[model samples]
Target: MSLVRISHYLALCGVASRRQASRLIDSGRVTINQQLATHTERVDSLQNLDICVDGVAVLAPQDKQYWLYHKPIGIDCRLLISDPSSLIHLLPQTPRLYPAGRLDKDSRGLLLLTNDGELTQALMHPDFYHTKTYVVQVDKPLTPAFLTQMAQGVTYQGAQTRPCCIRSLSGFDEGDTFEIVLTQGLNRQIRRMCQALGYKVIDLLRTKLMDVELGCLPENTMRPVSAAELLSLTQLSELTSLS
Candidate 1:
């Protein structure tokens, strides 16, 4: 039988990050086979071990599934909840597929869902600096000064954001539309950036993540990622790794 560290096993099962798993064990929230577990403990086989975290049982995924979902505005991305409006409930039932990254309830567009924890970690890691592009509509026309401030970075929540690319797009009826590409996925970063410049975002739609695009996928629909797309994404993450 093969053995694996408890934390590593938890991460593999999409329970949490390795560090967070350690904390969970230290806090006495994890159990193995009806007994409390420790961080240094090893499980002979994940399939044979009965693991629970905070009263919720977790099982390693037998197969990894990747999906490209068009998250409609107002749907919460958190899949753990039983709310019918959550993204998870909208999609066909599968084994514990989580969002690689989050899009807020008010924002809409391309969101990735997968059961591969390693891939999720790599895609969400700050070091990879994966690009997420958004088309934002603000209540007012975007001025050169506002665009410059965004591209140069803005101070939000006591830290200056990384410099990003921003350009105006035409053909909006009521408000100005602009495309912004960001490497960091801060909470509501685009909206906060506009708010910092005295503008309110009326609509936010993620258009692309790395090579994946929302395309013409209807709202609230999902489809399996093609093999070519997954291969390209993995390559990009490796090339941009900080370690």
Candidate 2:
């Protein structure tokens, strides 16, 4: 019997990322063969262990799936009891998946949804340092000092942000439009950074995540992750280490 960590098994079943699965186990939500499971415990995959979380049986591992969506502004990535505009309502019911990272309801752009929990963990973990690109519009005109300070890094909420690449976009009629590439995703990071610099973000749109791009995708649409894009992501050091 090939024994595997329960967290790995849960991740394979798309229950959650490995770390999150560990949390679930810690909270006494996971069971194997009707016995409570632990994070360090392993089970034989070939044995077809009766794994349950909160009394719901976990289905066998399914083929990994990946998708990219152009999230529209005003739509949340979460499934909230009170919010009717959550993105989950628009997605198909089969092949359950979760968003790799969240985009603010006020922000519109690319979001990756997948059943690959390992991939999700790799992308969301700060140590992986995956890059996301965004085009932002602020409430006022751009200043050289503002651009330089933003690129250098901004201190906000008692923590300093990592240095990021920022470039002003010319020829756009929008006031103070610029593109920024970030490796770390904090809560409302771009908006918070701009606010700390005395600039209010008028619009924020993410165009890319890692090697995946939102190119030409219409708003409120989703597409399967292309083979080339998946290849690029898997080739990254962080993902390769997962093997």
Candidate 3:
């Protein structure tokens, strides 16, 4: 293997993102062959190098694993200090696994977890335009105008959101329920869009992302993604890369 930058190597090992890996090196938490490593250092041979992050050895996984997790509301997607409610702690005690995309603490539904950093980068990259679908409940009945605005793209904080697909789900005991599909994953995007239209989101649940669906998986549980699913994901990544 060719010599790779420490940050990129660390990212491939699932220790952190490239930027986070650089920060780790600068903070003196990373060591190469038992000596403190610098952000500019490169690993001549991944197999021969002894890389450690905060005393934990960093090694790339031989086989990347992908999982579909039904994250429950109130559980954080990222690891939290001393917090068992985090997705990291909830997952099996395996190294190098990280969430592909995040669902805020108040939101719940399907979340993808994987050890493949490259795949994560591809799926999360803005250029990929991966679609994510959500089932949302709002405090008021949705007007045709509201739906139109959402589908046509609404301006938020001086920037217009990308056009999205929106449909009303039949039968809601309270408030209005709608299915929204977005190609962009903005921070608290669904909630913010509703807020901008004078609607308060009471509950938000992500139902699908790309070709993966939440299905009937129990909350707080996870299972390996199927081979067919992985193929679809990889094909999508390849298409994005070419584009």
Candidate 4:
């Protein structure tokens, strides 16, 4: 392993993101070989150095795991131990894992969970423009103008969202459902955009993320991401890094 910054090393060990790891080091909670870690310290795990966070030892996981989960609605995405609504309790037992992206509490969808920090960082970065697809049902009948406005781009809270691909999904008697694909993940983006257009979202569900599809995965269930999918993700990450 090449030398990496202390924060990056900690993130690779699944402690937290690089920024959070820096905060831990700054607060004197991180130590390398029993000495307080420094922001400028670079570490290589091959040196057999002792890395501890809050006196608990952390090691780079030898078997990095990736999983796709159907995140049911009303579950917080955080891994908070104290919050009963957090999805951490529902996940399978494994090395500490983190979400590559997030789905808001009120929305249910496909979520990617993995212990690979570098991959998570790459996938979540705005510059990557990874696509996430969602199916939404609103409180009123659908209109051509509404679809056009959403597809064109909506300005909400002073920022115009990127233009997205959206089309109505027929079959529901209510006839107000639409499928939308967005390359940007904003906070409650769909709900906010709908609200800005004087519409209330009735229900929202994510069906796909990047190259992975929700498919027939039952709600509240999870499965290991396939080897082929993992290869694709790693290749995409590498390509983005090079770009």
In candidate 3, position 122 carries an lDDT of: 78
* TM of each candidate vs. truth: 0.87, 0.90, 0.87, 0.90
Q: Candidate 1 on 19-130: residue-level lDDT in tens? A: 5568789999999888899877988654666889888787764577788899988899866566877876775554667788899999999988876666776777786678
**What is each predicted model's overall lDDT from 0 to 1?**
0.81, 0.86, 0.83, 0.86
Stretches of model 1 off by over 4 angstroms after superposition: 16-29, 45-47, 82-84, 171-175, 236-242
- TM-score, cand. 4 vs. native: 0.90
Angstrom error of the Cα, residue 42, model 4: value is 1.0
Alpha carbon deviation, residue 13, candidate 1 (Å): 2.6
Cα misplacement distance, residue 143 of candidate 3 (Å): 0.3
Model 2 TM-score?
Answer: 0.90
How are the candidates ranked when ordered by lDDT, highest leading?
4, 2, 3, 1
What RMSD does model 1 have?
Answer: 2.9
RMSD of each: 2.9, 2.4, 2.7, 2.4
Better of 3 and 4 by lDDT: 4
Per-prediction tally of clashes: 0, 0, 0, 0
**Candidate 4: pairs in clash:** none
In model 3, pairs of residues that clash are none
